[model samples]
Target: MIESMTPEQESNKPKRQFNNLVNNPVMEDYSLRYAPQSFRKWSEYAVATSALGGIAYLADFAIGASIFVTYGFASGVWAVILAAVVIFLTGIPIAYYSAKYNIDMDLLTRGAGFGYLGSTITSIIYASFTFIFFALEGSIMAQGINVYFGLPLPWAYLICSLLIIPLVVFGMTLLSKLQVWTQPIWLVLLVAPFLAILFKDPGAYGAWTHFTGNAKGGASVNFLSIGLGAGVALSLIAQIGEQVDYLRFMPEKTEKNSGKWWTAVISAGPGWVILGALKQLGGGFLAFYIFGALGATLAVEPIQQLIKGFGVLIPAPFIALTIATVFVFLSQVKINVTNAYSGSLSWSNFFSRMLHWHPGRVVWLFLNVGISLLLMEFGVFGFLNTVLGFYSNVAIAWIGAVVADLVINKPLLKLSPSYIEFKRAHLYTINPVGFGSMFIASVLSIIAFFGVLGSTAQAFSPFLAIVLAFVLSPIIAILTKGKYYVARPDALGHSAEEGDTHALNCVTCTDDYETPDMTYCPYHEGDICSLCCTLEKNCHDMCKKPGVIEVSMRK
Candidate 1:
């Protein structure tokens, strides 16, 4: 056939077309595939440092103040510790799998127990966390700008929201550099004020511990108050998703770097709560100090707390305000970029699965930021407590289900598959194991949150979600008999044991892809890439045999 073709005819033959939508490094960020070993080229420490930089957000300060003011110091202190322990424990497995498997949280959720369409629900939930935190962090930045430059709050909000767009549009490439470059200065400003206070006023700790806050509990700890505060604090449990987004870039582990690899994974993964816990505790102390100096209203504002704290070091009010604004602006920008970046990836996964079309992740970037800007204008800061308290229920239910599949159902009961299989052709649309447990837990906890289960349950809404989802996931897996775990053999049949180097040309996209992203397409009678398969809604899953289980059976 080649000998028969004229030179011009052979020259005019079509070249393979790469799917721009799926292959764009800026847009996809490996959203739907295993992050190829080639792309995971950074040192373990560099990736971990970049991931850790996002934890420098000021929301902890605000969260600390709000909880302490409502629950008093003794209750708030215990609540913060409890929430940290839970977050640390839950974060470990989620982090390990993402780093080891080189997949984002949505992909991890799919393979864990929530099947194809089942994880789409979690995609939306994770997207909500990104925008909500974006708005909050942006609002704090706006408050700081107003404090420093006297700019109108609306304009400040716009500036804060828009500033992150350029940084996040390039995705991890730009973000990694930005985070590493800024880490040093952020750490300096972050710790200097706290250290100065401790050195200058050693008695502040005693006063803060004895402080009654605005509550009627006095200085003593109250069990009910502790529950309420922990519920508020546990709302941050979803933050591990953000951490793992970067962790998925960890270089492939080898014997040479095993020690460094393990250290980076643990410290940058679950150990984020160590710095986070300290920040919250420091924030509580600052809020109390500010309360004593200013009043209850001003104490809750992070900008005010920073200005007062920094004021101790710099005597001039003007200079102190400028320095404080710089600190707040840098911190907010660091976290908001992560929020926008992660949110875009989540929305990409969500809309591609739901609508079967992806305009590109950058489109979702603007959409996420626009919504967050509007939220900032609506004053999300004013409703922080109520919003976080309510959000904690759904967030915990989702995390609890994933963790249960990881720690309980997969090992203890042997009710879930050991391997993570995320491809659509190999997964059921819905897996009752994860979806059922999360749905039941979220509904029941929301009921408890509203006091339908009485005041005691109301205060512990998040705990109810944790317990119910953890207990229910395994039961559902056992009831369903582990049949929903994997729909078919891997796309390459033996891709895991033999590394998939053989490239297959996708029938629809006319592109070559590695086996992990390619699938057998009975409709086309040729191999198809995952993006093509996802976009091919017209096929109606005709590739599978008639009357077969929607959940594919392992071959």
Candidate 2:
């Protein structure tokens, strides 16, 4: 019996039973699948625009305003510049890898060393990224509502939070079109008022340039304040997850389109930060202008404050109120939709990975919105600076680990997997590499945020998170010897060395997925589609020869 076994069989390597699950293209979307050439469909321009569209959150405006009030325009300016630089530099590698390979952030994390189970924790973090920002953006919308219709902030919060459920339920297809359509209108509304104001009063620019408002530290350029402000803003760094959420649709790269592909990826991936920074600067400027005109300091209502700025453009009181409300509504709509979309995907990924059962992304949309609603009702926006300031630590840690894996660990030590391995059946439950890096960075950064570090360092905790994560990832990967990357021999499907692009099929759902999405599912005793595999809850992964990372770790 043994003698008859061929080498492939003699090795006792597991073969998938439900091949249809892995091949289904419609259900999976390469969520937990390998990104094959065929699945990467959208053009470069589409991906970039989709990514840039999501940055339309009003949090940037509020954040810039807060920084301007707390520090001066100079300090706020510096912080925005610094955060943008860091975001762009880190985004380059992440965007390049995800689009080049056509995997989502969750999938990328698997190959980056989070392993199968290990990546679950990151899922929560990533999910939080969506919901947290959703709350922020929703709150902004609520503020607009209160100003426009005299609605209570709480009711406004509920309205704003609940509205996205319908929009996101349709998923990427609707989202892409929505972004394309709204982008042009939002851009015009966003820029036109400011451009008009500048033309109307060229001297306003002069005043704005030199105007230093009520700075607690005496309005002088304080490096610590600047760094701290930047740290809070840097919380948005993990926003790349939202970007990659769309970029998985990017068209395949080839000799004919390689340059265009890379350019699109960068613009979509990290290039979003450039526009975000500009928007943030405008927010700061607007906040500054409002404060100057009011001849007062410290306004809790950003909308109320912003309304004053809009008054400078439109002479009529009622018309100006309407315009300001419209601007805020547009900004919030652009961002909250993205927030809901990304959150739903992240929540779907998280629970399915944990419970092995997926109801659908649409279900998670409600969950994500529910979480945002709670945060909104809890009045998290009241403590806006505090929440973002604390969150920046964790966000930085997560993004830092990701950047380290993509830019530093993968290239420097060769510990990174040759190709992205995102299928649940293909990776260890958890790998110490990404997890350890994130843990260490988060812990240290939290300490810094809490003032364990000195004042300046505390304000600049995000930078510290970046440094620590960047330093720790390669060391852990080298120490782990890349053992935990894959749980078993059969886990690695298709040779990446053959080429970067390939096609795959799902066993369940009977559709074609990317090679990355295709995985042998032991639960159904067949190759499972990424979506079913993601939603699967029964088998408990019986394919790894019974003693891989789980056993290794317990020992």
Candidate 3:
């Protein structure tokens, strides 16, 4: 079998499928697939504008308020800062790789040591991030609708979920326009209430700082409380995956545009945390102010927080209510479009691997929205802290494993390959280095979160996940000798060694693909695009021997 193949045998393979780009115009967004360099036609500034605009979400406000209300001002502030730093640091490498490789988080995970199928788990994790946030954001929108228009909560939930489908179904083309257009108003509305508080109540800042939360360490800066708060805030660490979904459309970096490229990558990538942290801080201050006016129960609610803040500027209850409602509605729309879009991409990747069907991203879009709608009806916002707290452990472990492979394993240990190879034909089914590390990290952190390790460890579960994943990735890489990184050398596939600018015709899809997205398909007897290869489950292990598939299938 090893000696059977010749150049003639390889070249004689027939094409299997036609490209479906005409039917799926929105497929340009390439959800469930790689964002190849050939398809990245947008300017850096355009892509950055779109990516940065996603951070306009009001969830930061709610998250900050929850932390401040639970842990008090000092601890809340410290947690926000600490979590931002960690999020920023971990986000940099992931962002850089996505933009540089022109692939979204799902594709990046595949090459980052998760292997082909191993990334399916991470994709589901990422999809959960999008929908959970979608449900949360949708609930926020429903609240605004209920407050202003007198709509039933259930109806509002359905409306909020439905409104985003039109905006997201067309993908980034319309989303970029929506984000760019709404950005100015969103910014003005976001800051207007804060500015009013600053001017009208100058002493509020001092009061906000001194006000301990309703927690046991009320008004004090407790380290344990900070740890817990940080853990909760770290749940947003998965938010980076969404950012990179847009950043993947960034123009390839070159000497001519290197500065602009770096600027876009940083600002749109980790720089999101800068704005996120500020929003959390602002949420803390607003929560404190709202607490004084509306009491603790209603203070953490963003609708109430904004209404109270705006109420200072407008004396009329109806006008203030309208302004706050509109602001919340707009903010929710901005973020939910992103949540839904990212969710579709994640779900596409996940189901494509598990079921071996490419149903187009739009199908998954509606599916994600439906799931989010269900969660909204269930009132996900009521248990936000618990959900995000538990989720942060798994999110961090997955991100930490990927980041460690990028920052530490590839560069320092040289145990793993330098370039990302995502095609199923080229990779093992499970690379123990990443899958193993993330599994161990998630298991330990979850147990610790349950207090099997102690209260201190319970509060620091996210931190533990990061440390364990970062440490174990390299350790496991060394132990496994990195043999699982690749099943066998696939010389026929486009790789890092090949120039990415060249276009190759995918034998399966019969469409032109850039080098990075093309892989050799033995069944088709030619180079096939990653999407086609992924969807072609019938091919089985024909491209490689049974032993290779056997190796990849083992833990």
Candidate 4:
């Protein structure tokens, strides 16, 4: 029996759909999938380099410097080390998950316990992570532009915000290429200033290490100082999201490539702190040297301090300015592009899950920039130290919860979901496990920060956030018996709640995915991969209405 062709089929038979290279794994950079085996063509070195490049922002220097100035050398140094250790340990599991599964951080959060709608708060947290830092890096860039071009502060903000747009529009593809190309140049400039300073006085950093200024306790290593310093340093804990964006592209580990895979993951993941710690120490050292050499009255910002530090190495003043300008610009460019790239991905995940609408990453790209611009206009720099100190608590809380899931809950009680259950059709709306826990942590920490819990508690807000979020997630998961975390088996794959090999197609990008990543999106009225399902605007979550545990609870 012959099947008759429908009107839609008859009209479209002659049309050739452009892959737009859409299905071409390289161009799209696995934007919609879990970096299927067919993709991940880059070498281990390239992947790690690309990943490392994302952390090249000048904020590390700025943060380190500010901590030094406010907390003194002992407090600042201790804080950097403590924060680095926290970030590195937490980073290990996150990097492993992203690299092993080839999924982005948003998808990872869903599988960990946030579920469909639940994971979204993490997206906002992550998006806020990006923009807050974006404003920071942009502020540094704007400061440089203002110094060099004599531009108005607002105009500098505009240029700093606008310059990175072209680079971030194509997302990871352009970023990977840009990062790869600039690696050597960035590396050279990063070291040149330090090398010159060292050459000028071999004993400079040595003396700087013991230098202390302004703090009432001096370098006596007081407990209050260390706690505050740690809180300040730990504020950058959210940087893991940016790392996962690149880790998603790591080639699937096989016997042949296992060593390289491990190497890449290590170098790009926790290894980010190697540079971060160094920069912090370097910034502290620079502040000491600059204050000593140029006198304490100069009152320069950290970025400007670095510029001047580099400028001295060039000897000829104008050429020194040019070199210093280029170094700062390149450093900001490298990091700001990453800030914008991660921001777009996060905003895309956030709004898509909440509103079920994704205009495109490019749209959120502008939104991210716009937010940073607003922060600049509001003069966020004035409160930078207080803000970072306060933010560290929430950041630590969020990352700590994720770390707890990865470490204790996943193994001890088997409470963690066995595989990442990211698809919309297969999970609850709000797990209450991650959502409820993080919300409680953030709320409590914020109150403590405002001194409702008193000055001692206020100083330890970051510690409170980390300890509370970590402790509560497992308690909630166990009390609830991990029921809200998953309502049904993730996919038609296995005996356990692990994913298997039922293949399906996306609605927008129209790519096939393993059953684990596919969802029945009502907007597309078909089975679409989670990424495409995420990108579609009109769904209104009709598919999950009956399934979401939150709705059931209200009913």
Q: Write one digit per residue (lDDT tens) for candidate 1, span 341-440.
A: 9999899899989998877788899999999999999999998889999999999999999999999887788878776677787788899999999999
Per-candidate clashes come to 1, 40, 2, 1
The TM-scores of all predictions, comma-separated, are 0.93, 0.89, 0.94, 0.88
Task: Estimate, for each residue in 253-351, the C-alpha lDDT of model 4 and write its tens digit.
Answer: 779989889988987988898899898777767777677556543323555676667766877767776777777788888988888878887877787
In model 3, how large is the Cα lDDT of residue 311? Answer: 93
lDDT, residue 424, candidate 2? 62
The candidate, 3 or 4, that scores higher on TM-score is 3
Descending-TM-score candidate ranking: 3, 1, 2, 4
What clash count does candidate 4 reach? 1
Quality of model 4 by C-alpha lDDT:
0.74
* C-alpha lDDT values of all predictions: 0.86, 0.74, 0.85, 0.74
Higher lDDT: candidate 3 or 4?
3
Candidate 3: segments with Cα more than 4 A from true spot:
2-25, 546-555
In candidate 3, what are the lDDT values of residues 1-555, reduced to their tens digit?
323446787677544543464246565377755676656778998898899888888889889999998998889989999999999999999999888877789888888878888888999899999999999889888888988889999999999999899888788888888888889899999999988888998898878878776878677678888889999899999999999999988887889999999999999999999999999998888988878667776777889889888998888999999999999999999999999989988988898789887667888889999999999898899887899999999999999999999998889988888887778888888888899999999999999998999999999999999999999999998898888887767655457645556888876667787777776655565677777887786667566665533333331
Q: lDDT value for candidate 1? A: 0.86
